[model samples]
Target: MINDKVLSIILGGGQGSRLYPLTEARSKPAVPIAGKYRLVDIPISNCINSDIKRMFVLTQFNSASLNKHISNTFHFSFFSSAFVDVLAAEQTISSDKWFQGTADAVRQSMHHFLAHDFEYALILSGDQLYQMDFNQMIKKHEEANAEISIATYPVNAKDATSFGILKTNEENVITSFIEKPKADLLPDWTSEVSEEMKGEGRNYLASMGIYIFNRDLLIKLMDNPDTVDFGKEIIPQSIHEHKTVSFQYEGYWTDIGNIDSFFEANLGLTDDIPKFNLYDQKQRIYTHARILPTSKISGTTLNKAVIGDGCIIHAAKIERSVIGIRSRIGKESVVINTYMMGSDNYESLAEIDKKKINILMGIGERCHIKNAIIDRNCRIGDDVKINGGKHLEDKETDTYCIKEGIVVIKKGAVIPKGTII
Candidate 1:
């Protein structure tokens, strides 16, 4: 069979301190991306598209929103075995501590996975942006008779420092591995990449942190509690003892590890043709099916902008931005190089007029926002100017925070009129 019965284990990352403010209220998997879908949707949708539907999302911190999103979005037929469940960390008699690392999280949740019948385990990272058909990777694994298969991507010397580097033999069997090799060692780490990649100076094969492990081997490895992380400890130790294969993926895959990379990845969608293809019909990025009206715009000149459903945009000019669902941009406001995560729900005009609302849930009139991320349900008063750049120091307040020169207005924050950042 081309596609076999497989289980997917999505590792919801730790506290997510790097993507803070966006991850302040929710877990990493639940953080909204590309205007609509959550980060977890990338892996789950890939599994669904590949006909491997049974999946579990492992998370520990702030999983309320994640739980809500999963429940509200995915619905499988009762007659079928397909399921998408969110598994949060729980205290058991054997171990009571929280998830220490990636491997430990799966080790704790192995009992749940054992109940399902599967020959292979497809493990994925929660915070990543890509569209892939995992069936191809599985086919390579089964054909190679491999105990482990890792999805590897060719990255340059500068990008190699951030990812785990892998070395494969002539037959594409992984011979050695190194975690975040320094730039000085990159000269010796160059591998055989495609000519296109060679021209781009991307020679080192970096682990994409996407792995496929045989069911029996995964069970055997889980017995040892010392191995905490797959990148730091597990893969490096197992490659020598077991047969491991490298599955090279030369596509638009990005690790949403920090604010700077996350910002760039979201804004990159505005390009003429984004590397991350969201419009692919076969490989769709699934998310919540919200009942929202069509977006309404008046006097807004949108250039290279992506607007989601049910938005009321009256901005004078919006250039190179992603306006999310149910967003409201006021008259004469200009938004550039920003990602505005739309509100969860709409505020009625009656409620606003009766109470004489001070600030509305969206960009206010005559505002200027550039190089910033306005989180969900933010209320910015009129005449607000937020220009995010390297000139400002990193700081955080009750309403908003600045990281890597990007101003992130906190969720549900209200900025007073005439405020300047």
Candidate 2:
């Protein structure tokens, strides 16, 4: 069981501008993944698997969908003290603006956290995909008597430029840090990981944006009104004054920051041996349990595809794709290398006929779509062709868009018949 000494705070990113259109309507964490689960489920499921009870998610942009998902999905028994609640950015007499940064977001919501009883405040990023047992990290924190402990993963020289890299002594005490440093600017000092980590070709310790701080030390750190971000301001300053240390995690961790990364991560799940496993019964990812019929397929061919529940596939060819719930594909259509976020509700035969449209809520017959993202509630007409590879740079229109060679049919978009791009 998770001890009462720890309380968790998940930082749902501000605005999520990097993950555009996907974050267009919902917050970053609320963006759905793996065909059924939202991005937030990764962190929350990790906490639940670790037996942690009390957790708060802080979000500032487009939080209505996120709030509704959390409220409808997670419910603790009346007898239990556990709760997963959202603390949105609100203006009070003391604070007038929205969350300026990660640190500021937590600082603004300190009142809600202070009301609860806990010793250490565990901070985590909501957009990351990974599974970890926090009890182990907390145990290390107490053993080292560290005022602050940051969870770290080793990264190679090529990938090191995109993360917050740090130098530590042999004892794992952090000495210096650099945020998104150039290769030449990296610190000379190097910390050693276990033999297991060395096998993975990891050379530098990259911060996972996960931290554990003593309750009092956290409040004191946030006391300064000027320090807004942790990686940019607070962490660099804390190395000298606080007993800061690193807890090494040599596991699969992916930061779903932008559209390219998000697309690749989702498609990676279709690999023969995926790095991140969603089938582990001991530590399974949880989400809203929607009641729907089993997926029905007739004369369809699928290869390396993960299809969700309540889908009707009719003589379609789907390869290397992740199809979401309530999806419908008509005869002879081909979907290749796509991430199809399916419809919210299924349309009946009567409703489909009444509309008299070429497509009804899903892909139409004889359509050829490749390397694209079909957002929810899309009506792709028959004979429509969308090839992200054709338009490599970027193009945006009311009907469709191409970002980084990935065609994104906007949410609720209606593509007419014989449309080609």
Candidate 2 global CA lDDT score:
0.90
Model 1 C-alpha lDDT versus the unseen true structure: 0.93
Q: Quick one: best TM-score, which candidate?
A: 1
List pairs with backbone clashes in candidate 1: none
Q: What do the candidate models score in CA lDDT, each in turn? A: 0.93, 0.90
TM-score of each: 0.98, 0.97
lDDT of 2 by residue, 167-257 (tens): 8897889999988888786546346877776676677899999999999999999899899898889899999999999999988899999
- Model 1 lDDT per residue over 191-260, tens place: 8888999999999999999999999999999999999888898899999999999999998999999999
Q: Where is the poorest 10-residue window by lDDT in model 2?
A: 185-194
How many steric overlaps are in each model, in order? 0, 0
Q: What TM-score would candidate 1 get against the native?
A: 0.98
